[model samples]
Target: MGSSGRRQSRRAVVVATVTPLASILGSGLLIIVPVLERTLGALAVFGAVAICAVAWLIGTVIRHNVLVVEPLKGAGSLDRATLLLGRIADATIVVAYIISVALYLRIMAQYLVRFFASSAPDFLEPLIACVAVALIVALGILRGFRGLERLDRVSVVAVLLLTFVLGAVLLFHDGSSLVGGDLTMPPVPRMNPLEILLVLGGIVITVQGFETVRYLGDQYDAVARVRASRVAQIISAFIYIGFVAVATPVMGLGTPAGADSTLLDITTRIAPWLALPLVLSAVLSQFSAAIADTAAADGNLRGLSRWFHGPRPYLISGAAAIAIAATVPTFTIVAVASRAFAAYYAIEAVIAMRTSNGFARKSFYAVLALLLVAIALFALPAS
Candidate 1:
């Protein structure tokens, strides 16, 4: 392709990539905001923000400068730790999906329990997420990046319009009340700095979509993909922060009703018509993000085998995706999958960090190892 043509193509790639990623990240923050406000406290949530910022900066910088990121890394096993750079991107996607799915299921369950205490189940949400993961991996193995990108773009438009219209309604109707935050919050709730780090860890997972670019490394121009990935990451992070800022004050941290979507509920109060559309769009967006993340895991595995000297690790690339799907099986299953997806994200982040930094960074992996244990515990099937 000519330079002008390539530039246009690159621009198209950026549009296609950035929109869906930003949408996914925005949705993710909807979940994280409440968790920070309630579970970790606002002060503690900052730690999560700091950790995520540093980890992502390191990951992105390495991908852009130090590595020659190739999408199809397993092409010849050893020549491609060069390919491992792709992990930075994959780490971002997986982490966000897991965290978002967990929040989605958790929020839905709380609502369900209020209406039908006997019928509601906690574990079901993640199981459904896991099933979606399977569909995602299966489709990813068969389809190309173009198809996924198209899905993301379509999802982004539907989601943004739906969220904006509905969220506005909820905010205007509900947030204007002076007695609002007090309605759902405890008398003496407080925020700490440490728990904020955990919240930051959760939110960081939401903004990650850089890996998508690496998959198209060969199809699109390299410089464009790299630049696009960086831009996409920045845009996604901003959206996440913006959504949380807009959402937290309106929803109040103590209430689960406003948590999954503090913004949406506010809109529901003002313009209830927006509720059904918002939920539908929210679910669809989550599903699309899950598929995209699973595909990324496949791509990450393909990249990792290059250095492991493990005969190109084809099956391993698809293993987590497949196993996750098999366990959850369908949309009916949510809890297991959501938890697994979260676990996957945490693992991917630590691994990506470990791989990029020298062995001197080995100690970080140990810390990551501990973080994984904590994630597993927090996201356990029963919990």
Candidate 2:
């Protein structure tokens, strides 16, 4: 290939990676600092690493399936049991996407409302979220998502730039504070080991979007999709760990009443001038994520059922998100979405175990499947 051809190939991979990368960081980057600081305090960075590690392991399973089982299924070689499992996995992921759509818009609504009125009524957040969902669904129905899909690249680039800038500024601030003998780690509420584990499990949703690559087979070859998934996970893991490490020490001493906007507070304290930019990034990230997941859910539904063709899936997802946004607490929505995705991952692991060869690989998949099941069963919302 010529240099231009190589560049285009690289750009295609990057563009393929952006969907999952944006989905992974979209809402997680906004809420992780407060959630980790409140739960793990001085150990927050380590906790972030642990979550990323789990996410990486799960991503490995997904990549394995992409390379192994996908071919078998594609060739119509899978047995009835594995095919049944695949159907269930598809449905599970669709549900997860719907819940995530709610979680994203809810967080976005919090940032939007709080940006305008610090003391807005509780109802306003959900109201804004529902309205946004309506608009996205209407757009999806009337025009399709070709235009809104561009936001994935825009939001992902803006977020990566803003996040690195914030991390650098925070690290500089921390260094100056430490040099001046003024650095202090924030206090956190102590939790039992079980509680801690549950909280971590609940956070799986934060790093849950890598599976988006599995459904992109139409756009890219399996090799490209697998490569993109791995790269996205690696990049997101570093971003999550580094961001958490720098921001944890400067987080508020206790859980704020509203955890969704915690990053805004930290940014305001560290760099007031960056607050508006951060909020703008937050809005972009959240809305982009919601649109991605909404589209994914719609696609999955169509794949699973003939009845879900056209705009029906979009209408269903929009209605479900609005209902959840109105009825569920933000943290509770996070936990529920986490469990939903964990369940989907657990099912995918089973498919991997069944299709992949070798005792060692099968054992690994079995163990990971059990762990994911535990997470699905036990993950608790952060307080």
Candidate 3:
């Protein structure tokens, strides 16, 4: 490739790699923020960002160490414990994806009912999103990461643009609110250490997409993958911080019609003209994210079993996702998913430390400590 060609290729790789990560992270914020609010109030934004930074470090190390060129296998130590733990970690990730899709379906359904078609039944959004996801997976419409990434490039850009517009309007309307705001770290209350710990543990799920870097083993060199993953994490952090900073303060200004309607709530409060567009963007972004996640879950399923390594695995998995989405409430599944993911992170920390050496191993040890603290918090009673 020529210099121009090289640059274009690089941009595509970055976009392809980063956009799905961005989509997944953007969709996750709605669920993550509320969990944070229970413990840190507005400071949850900063806490979440801090966790992202550490997650980025830990994820990059794992990605570097666990390169998987083949879709069905990973490169790592061959001990039975390592292999068993690796399967558990991968299975845990698959479970997270499934639960997230169910939550997305419920949220999407609510958005459609409230904004787009008041007469539409509450079940419409999940039905449509589930069918779309099923068709895409079953038909193999998305060829691989590259295809999904192409779709995500558009989805992520639309999501970020609308989010920027919303944040800008919110900030302009309430610049004073933020100015007088003391964003200093608040002391954790002494009375409910257990309750506080669970919230802290849940915050770990906010940085869920960083591990996605491992899938790039086939398409990019190690250096390229590292740079791309780091860039994606930084972008996601700013996006999360920007939204939380603006949205959390403005939340009290207007009541969202429903729990899942934060984006619509803020946009309607500060810039009514932007609400529809924001809603549209959010729906599309989330739908795209659902597709990406469903695809990923199917891929992981195939990786885990030879019977699943066929044309119908996506169909089977996608149907299961739809079934789960159709039956469950949003937050209930979200809470379950968050706890499951926290467990995954805890296991992942052990795996990374066990398989690593030198500085990487030390870093995993530090992260392992953090994960343990977070997990212990979850074991405590609600404050």
Best by lDDT: 2
Candidate of highest TM-score: 2
| Residue-by-residue lDDT tens digits, candidate 2, 1-383 | 99998887777788899988988999898888877876888789989999999998999889988998888988999999999999999999999989999999999988888777889888998998899999999989998888676888899999999998999999999999999998888775679989999998998989988998887888987878888998999999999999998987687765452232378888888898998898899899998888888888888899888999878999998999999998898889999999999999999999999988899999999999999999999999988
The segments of candidate 1 whose C-alpha lies over 4 angstroms from its true place after superposition are: 1-10, 19-27, 40-52, 65-149, 170-188, 252-271, 299-383
Candidate 3 Cα outliers beyond 4 Å, as residue runs: 1-13, 32-39, 42-44, 64-77, 117-138, 141-149, 176-193, 253-261, 359-363, 366-383
Instruction: Quote the lDDT for 131 in model 3.
Output: 68
Shift in Å, residue 321, candidate 3: 1.4
What is candidate 1's local distance difference test score? Answer: 0.47
Q: Report lDDT (CA) for all predictions.
A: 0.47, 0.89, 0.62
Between candidates 1 and 2, the lDDT winner: 2
What is the C-alpha lDDT profile of model 1 across 5-33, one tens digit per residue? 97797676666466435533534544555
Residue runs of model 2 more than 4 Å from their true location after superposition: 1-8, 254-261
Backbone clash count for every predicted candidate, in the order shown:
34, 0, 2
State in Å the error of residue 252, model 1. Answer: 4.1
C-alpha lDDT of residue 194 in model 1 = 53
Clashing pairs in 3: 197-377, 198-377
